[model samples]
Target: MKLPTDHSFFSSIRRLLHTYNLPTAYQLLESPPSKEVWKTKLNSAVDQHTVATWQEDIQEKPSLKYINTDALSVGKTHHLYTYVRPNRIDMLTAETKAKLLTGTYTLLANRAVFNQYAVNEPS
Candidate 1:
């Protein structure tokens, strides 16, 4: 939801993996699942490296460990970030096309900030 405009390679990869695993914000509100459910879903959707990265970036961070209930409503106005290659545009399903037309999804093309300071900064 509220698709991040950061289109850098690593940021895109992270978003893709997170979306593949986690439920949408709306889904979380409809059925507030436990952390274990989230973890299981994450593990099922990604490789070991991704999972380990999640552990280090999110799970290990005190601020990010708990769900932020306030942010769940963001999905109502914005769809998840989706990247489609130019050549693969024709491969999208009818439903996906409809969503895109309806402005439920965003196609971000902006460059992400990726300086060394940002990468090396401690959380």
Candidate 2:
């Protein structure tokens, strides 16, 4: 999904950087980069944080010999494909989904609408 260049969006990223104790990254928020650049940086930070936490949690738990690491990798890939990217069938709201199904919503129009909807969507 394209990152929204709205103030609230940047503010949330600033808070996330602070929460992660990533002072260097937090500093970048003071003079934010271009939207594309910022999005890349943010994605990198999030991915690193996710992997770090997951590794830590796994280390704390008992090892499961039957667990297939390859399967776990595939599951993570599936999750990213299903939820992280935009324009997915399941990510659309009911109203939008209906419009799409009825051929009222074109991809071109939906891109703009979906980006706005995604930005304003509640956590």
Candidate 3:
């Protein structure tokens, strides 16, 4: 009985939402002589963005503090843009913390945010 071996279906499909790392030599790869400099510069910029994002991810806080990295980096970010306050804060006044947490998450998780971060560069 030669059983079919394609068991990893869901895992492969899930990869669509994952971002893959770009190689270091992407800019230097062989290309047509036309627009070489422009292409190289753009590639370098994109790579730099990726590197910054990677650094931010490595430094992400373990606690529930919210940090925004969109302006800071593009590649390394784990799709955590927008307001990310604590789920529940006991130290602060209830009214203030609740107000801070209420529509902030909703505003952050709007349709646009979902489109932007639902897909992420999975490590």
Candidate 4:
């Protein structure tokens, strides 16, 4: 569950998507890479595109937002990456806030988003 800060965040995002059996990272790309493309390099470009695209995508979907380690409390973000945002922190029930403190809430909440973007393409 740790993200390597030295590399682009999308590399970690792509890894998490696979580890969680989530969606294809290609959806974040303007033009998906070909089979012959070197993934490490292509992913660097995709990372930039993803952040920009996600920022735009959420503009029209106010109910949803992208949450990343940078937005979390320092203690909670050392090993985190992007996930779908939950309800406002101030409005969370005590029990729900507890889950966020424990990281369980993020894991569970992100599943719905993962499924929403999931692809059936063979690997």
Tens-place lDDT digits, model 2, residues 1-123: 866564677677767776565555546758768889877766766766776666666667765343344454411544333443455555556446566555677786566676755444448
Q: How many clashes show up per model?
A: 0, 0, 3, 0
Q: Which lDDT tens digits does candidate 3 get at residues 69-103?
A: 44454434323323445555432445454555544
Candidate with the larger lDDT of 3 and 4: 4
Q: Write the per-residue lDDT of candidate 1 for residues 6-122, one digit (tens) a residue.
A: 886657766775667665555677998789987776666565554456557765677666644334332143333244344555436545776676566544421124333434435
For lDDT, the strongest prediction is 2
Candidates' RMSD to native: 20.1, 17.6, 18.1, 20.1
User: On residues 1-123, what C-alpha lDDT tens digit does candidate 4 reach at each position?
Assistant: 876574778777877666444446776465665655646555655565566556676666755455552453422433323342465654356556567866678664477576867555458
| Candidate 4 whole-model C-alpha lDDT, 0 to 1 | 0.57
Indicate which candidate wins on TM-score: 2
Report how far off residue 50 is in candidate 2 (Å).
0.6
Alpha-carbon shift of residue 32 in model 1 (angstroms): 1.6
Error of 3 at 84 (Å): 38
Scored against the true structure, residue 65 in model 2 reaches a CA lDDT of 40
Q: What ranges in model 2 sit over 4 Å off?
A: 1-15, 21-26, 63-76, 79-123
| Decreasing TM-score order of the candidates | 2, 4, 1, 3
Say which prediction, candidate 2 or candidate 4, comes out ahead on lDDT: 2
Query: Residue 91 deviation, candidate 4, in Å?
Result: 25
lDDT of 4 at 82: 34
